[model samples]
Target: MTIGLMLNALGAGVGATTVDATARDTPSASSFGIGAAIWVLISNLIGLAVGAYVAARLSGTSDNTDGTLHGLAVWGTTFLISAVLLGNLVAGIASTAATSASSVLGGVVRGAGSAASAASNVAGPGGLQSATQGMVDRVQRALSGGGSPASMTSDQRNAEMATLATRWVTDGRMTASDRERLNALVAAEYNIPVQEAQQRVQQAEQQAAEAVRRAEETARQAADTAASGAATAGFAIFGIMLLGALAAVFGARRGTRDVLLVRGTGNVR
Candidate 1:
């Protein structure tokens, strides 16, 4: 196991140097692609096989079955240990990342010199008064109904219609009174007849419904595509693992040294 890990580390070192050779040149995208993956896979396979052979040979078992089993045991034990270490590493990284932002913020707040920087711009002079005044202005405007709907500017007319349309979409259907008001707002804002306003509202509603349907369909297709990719990756991983097991068995079997009995070897054949 130690031998295999050492070999893997050596290979990784070599690969790191090879891939980083462009450091002095113009920066480019990573050269680590399918070829890098293949290299890692092949190197790992060799390590496992070599480790398994060493394990079988060291066990002093001349039987092929025992040798193969010994190799398998080595492979399994190595993988189990690796999985535990990987899990711990992953957990540590995740925990640190999750807390890093909060930790920095907490540190900044605890430090007197950094506390001012940590605070929001809302703490500046007149910030509170300005924010409160803005809120009061919005409230007053809402209460005033922004003046009569018909007397509004073009931008105001468009904004009022958009707000009403949003409410209609949220409510799933506009009430008869709301629809009547919308038709009047549309007629006044667009300077069109009531009939045309009603037709425009119908068209907008249909278009919104169609957009929602298309969005739903797109989400479903994306989900299916992701599921398919996951399945393919799972199968590929399974095949690679199976191949590694086979390699371990082969290496172990081949490592079974030929043992001859003293009495039988008396002929020196």
Candidate 2:
């Protein structure tokens, strides 16, 4: 495990040096990522192989099955150790996050308490009344739709918009009369010709529909890409693990072969 970690560190150092020494005018981020992953895999395989070989040798096992079992045990041990290390790292991060969240919650609670303490001041003269007046003015300005409606007050426009919105939400479409009514409302509000207002409304509807279609297409494509990426990652993880196991088995077999060589030289059974 130590040997494997050392190899990993050495590879990391070499990779860092290589990146720093690169003179490429247009370096691709993905290429660097792939290189790092490959290096890490190689380092891990080498470490597992060496560890398994040593374990088998120390067990003094000449049997292939025994050697293989030793290698598997080494692999399992190393995997467990790595998992524990990763778990600890995750736990530390969670702790730090929890700490920060608590701090934020505490600040929010303090602010709420301060607000409660100043409730009398908030209820004092010209406070709530001014805020309410400001909100009403803002609403009037919004309902005015960039200016005062040419033939209607802000309240009338607001009521008309609310009714139109309700109709659309409830029935999802406007009838011919509804279309005419909307066109007249727009024409009256902006003092434009009814024909021009109708054209504008049609254009707005088409643009809105197109925007929705494009959004749906983009979302579907994003989902497909995410699924493809996840599948690839899953398969790659399985393949790398399988290769590491094979490396361990091969190393153990070599260790057993070495044992036979020693036995034959010593003239022992």
Candidate 3:
């Protein structure tokens, strides 16, 4: 199985490189295709067959059944070993990808935290008697409602916005109540007319919708690629295993016949 895996990997690499070079100028250039899959299947089948044949020949069995069993054992042992190694490799890759994604998300969170800290510290040593306080006083005068988000500290405002954005993403749209609150906050903070605030909200909504559409499309393409790869792998595995079994049986039969012929010839002599 080890030999088979090595040959399959080498053949796949060469085949993919060759295909890529040949299709370099083509619009539909792709390294993966039916040809590549077939090549991998054939390489593995040949390797496993060769291994099985060698085992049968070395077993020195006159019985075809015994030789066949030995060949089957070889194929089974190699397959198990390969499966364990491949499984570990795949697990390692998945773990690394997950860790990288988490790290990126954590960095974004940390950046947001730093920005909020900077906003809060704009008051400097003057405490509440700073420029930030002046802005707060103006916001209080602008907002008629006591629940204006403009009165929130920068960190609180950031947290609220994050929560709203999360809700929009999860629900696929902003609720009317959330939109109204957001519009009120925007109008109070920017000292804009209600109509202009509504327009701004509408534009933000459109942009968010576009972003969601793009994310969905990207996810769909990734899923399609994964599905195609999985289907191809499944077919290759089935074909290779079947071919390996047949090759081993044939090799065993030939080995047994040769051994019996040699023994009979010796008896006659």
lDDT of 2 by residue, 148-250 (tens): 3465675666667667757864785678876777777778867789899899878876776787789999999999999999999999978987888998998
Give candidate 1 misplaced runs (Cα > 4 Å). Answer: 1-31, 103-137, 140-166, 171-178, 189-203, 262-269
For model 1, what is the error of residue 167's alpha carbon versus the real structure, in angstroms, after optimal superposition? Answer: 4.0
* Cα-based lDDT for every prediction: 0.77, 0.80, 0.74
RMSD to native for every prediction? 5.6, 5.2, 7.5
Per-residue lDDT tens digits for candidate 3, residues 104-166, read: 999999999998788667746676467767888766544334365667554444445556667
Better of 1 and 3 by lDDT: 1
TM-scores, one per candidate: 0.69, 0.74, 0.55
For model 2, the run of ten residues with the poorest summed lDDT? 141-150
Clashing pairs in 2: none
Top candidate on lDDT is 2
State how far residue 40 of model 1 sits from its true place (Å): 0.8
